[model samples]
Target chain A: MALCQTSVLKVYHAVIEDVITNVRDAFLDEGVDEQVLQEMKQIWRNKLLASKAVELSPDSSDGSHPPPIVANNPKSNKAANAKAKKAAAATAVTSQPQIGGSSSASSLVALKSSAGMAAGSGMKNGLVPIKQEVNSQNPPPLHPTSGAALLQKQQQAASSGQGSIPIVATLDPNRIMPVNITLPSPAGSASSESRVLTIQVPASALQENQLTQILTAHLISSIMSLPTTLASSVLQQHVNAALSSANHQKNLAASKQLDGALDSSDEDESEESDDNIDNDDDDDLDKDDDEDVEHEDAAEEEPLNSEDDVTDEDSAEMFDTDNVIVCQYDKITRSRNKWKFYLKDGIMNMRGKDYVFQKSNGDAEW
Target chain B: MSYQLYRNTTLGNTLQESLDELIQYGQITPGLAFKVLLQFDKSINNALNQRVKARVTFKAGKLNTYRFCDNVWTLMLNDVEFREVHEFVKVDKVKIVACDGKSGEF
Candidate 1:
């Protein structure tokens, strides 16, 4: 059955009323303004009317309203302001790690203080002191190579067998500084990920624009020099583990089916090796192999259900047609293998219009 | 099954959009938004159960696809004709997602 547009609107109004009335106590307990709840309802109604799926009376919105929400539908600009503050704080944190290792520790302190201020203060003016404190700590490097020179000195001191423990303690904090900086860029911007790698060299050692080439060469050489034997051994270990686990599972299955199946166990081992190869090369042939394996080992390991209930609903929304019905099924039975459905409490979006139904009966076959 | 699936419907979608806007403005937390959605679930269920009194009957030329899993039925129909009172609406394709009716009772 089809419902008229007016009834759809009426149902929506009741839903809005019930939701707001029910949720008001929670909002009140949280110390949130009642006005915000009203604003949300107003925005919800406005958006529904804007959909143009149904004609709503213009006077309904204009008449007998209690402080109509701002036309923009935003009640406050707090999150935007917080984002701006966070961006500023992020730049400050990222720049500080380079000055000195000790400074990195202090930058953490500054970050925490700035974050606290950002959260508690509604006024932008409160952030000025925090920014200024961060800026004061970010003194210009004495020389671009000073950090490298310090690292060189630390290494020299360690090699000389002098008190290397203090130098090591100072160096450890800078190594961890990158991890702290990674936390601030919530947007995951590429530019934020690119940190300044200060490479120390004598004036004659580097030419302009050659640094990137040198860096890339070093990176490639390091990658090319990977320990192949160690990697092979690790991979071999993983394969052995999988084979053993698969064999154990097969044994479990065999035991459950019938005892003393040695010949079957040997055949299963060979099949498992083939399954491993198929898993490694997950191509069209692997799917056929998997089906074969499923037929034999169905009792050993049930294949995971690739689609669960959540994705089922998501796929419904993802379906091309908006002509969809979401309802409750009271009974679904097959008479002579022809499907009959009895459904109720349904909401449907069909042909760009909304509908609500109390009962639905449907018939289909195979 | 809960009315969370209804969030895909027009009314639920609009309500969610409104709540999202409020959350973005920092006027509400995600926790409160969740509470609001729960309320919406109950509200929509009750409204549909008690307020709406329409009955619909439909016949499909072909059940293009049918899936039953997790006690839910997802059926894709082709050449659907819905009859309500004296009105008839025909659509080329429609998808039906039905949850167990008795399972959602609170």
Candidate 2:
């Protein structure tokens, strides 16, 4: 049996429903609204659907029929961001007149209408409509960037945890200025401090939940304030760790070239020498040969050190790519250092989609 | 002791991202986000256990690295081939992180 995109979507839907159902009371206990939990689920599902990487058609077991047209325009995106901020801001400014009649019907519906209005006003304001034709029926889609920024800001506030009055002010203006006014200064110093704290703190410093909460808050704030590429930089750091080994090899070859008494070096000969120094000693009669031989022995061990560090960092690298498996090992048997793994309850992310598996057997050697 | 490793998956990342949006807007707290993730752990584990009946088998051309730490097995495989009933998917490299399924209070 194999899981398809639809099945994966179904599993995701089930998981969201299950989580909301279970965590609702806990959140309520913490003075959080049940509606907020539902909204979180909606936002989570919408963002996943927007990825358009997985198909959640109407006929699928996943019953929430996502909006047909994902409008992917600046207008809709702005509207979505504004609506989110307004929703966040609504709690703070209880006096402001709700955009729509009822608070429940207001957010999404108001976003659709307001998105059209914003789009309409933009066109009237000499904003040239390039390829996008303003259609009322097709409201602006929830673009992921605005959604990410929105989340970034939200997490930044949430990290502050309590009495974060400044966040409301930041959102009220609906301009980039507020972020600069509120975040950059404190976030710069705090981010470095928290990062050091996270590094210094042991796994058992606080309760798991509290630790996760603190780390997540720090991570979100730092990520939000990062001026460079956002998520890509985080991922690049991980990839670079693995890449360092390759780079070390390249550097090793370069050093070998210089050590060869400035002779015009052949790449193949250098590679062969690195692999087998004894063979290289017989093959190449070069000056400074003793120095090169001694350097090769030391250089050979550098890659192993690189490999060790890479493996240590492996635990932190996210397995969110298309070709990874997040699962549970029922039992792992090792005979003569060869291992056989029995895995279960697996979510295999492959081929740019997701799959669920009940049982899997993997064969590998130590 | 619900498995939190799945939180690194795409679904988990999206939820965290969404929760971030809510938190940044002051709609929810970081604590609430953590609660959501805990629930997510339980929910996803249960969903995968009860809903998915599919079985898969795979062989690795070479197991690059393997580590067993904290009752979790992390295996990095190169040149792997996965076979399902109907199709097969081959990947250059794949990482498998499996936690103790039956060890926790599910």
> lDDT of each prediction vs. the true structure?
0.56, 0.56
* Cα RMSD of predicted structure 1: 19.6
Every model's DockQ, to 2 decimals? 0.52, 0.37
Q: Residue pairs in steric clash, candidate 2?
A: A151-B21, A153-B24, A154-B23, A154-B24, A154-B25, A155-B24
How displaced is residue A205 in candidate 2, in Å?
A: 51
Model 2 C-alpha lDDT per residue in residues A1-366, reported as the tens digit of each score: 346445777788888888888888888888887788777777777767666646665565244544524522332375478778878888767645443333345353333333323322322232211112212332222331232322333233333333322222223222211011122222224332211111222212111111111222224334544544443354234323423433354466545543333233455456533432222221221212323434664565566557776887775564323578889988988888577889898877766667778888978765
Q: What is model 2's native contact fraction? A: 0.76
The number of the candidate with the highest TM-score is 1
Worst 10 residues of 1 chain A by lDDT: A177-186
**A197 Cα displacement, candidate 1 (Å):** 27
Tens-digit per-residue lDDT, A1-366, candidate 1: 336445787888888988999999999999999999898887887677666564454545555543333443343244356567778899888877544433344443333223322222211121111111112233322332222222222222223323222222223221311100001111223322212122222211111111111221112122222244443343334434544454455455443433221223434434543544422111221222223344555444332222344577787554558788998899999877588889898887778877778898989877
**What clash pairs does model 1 have?**
A1-B56
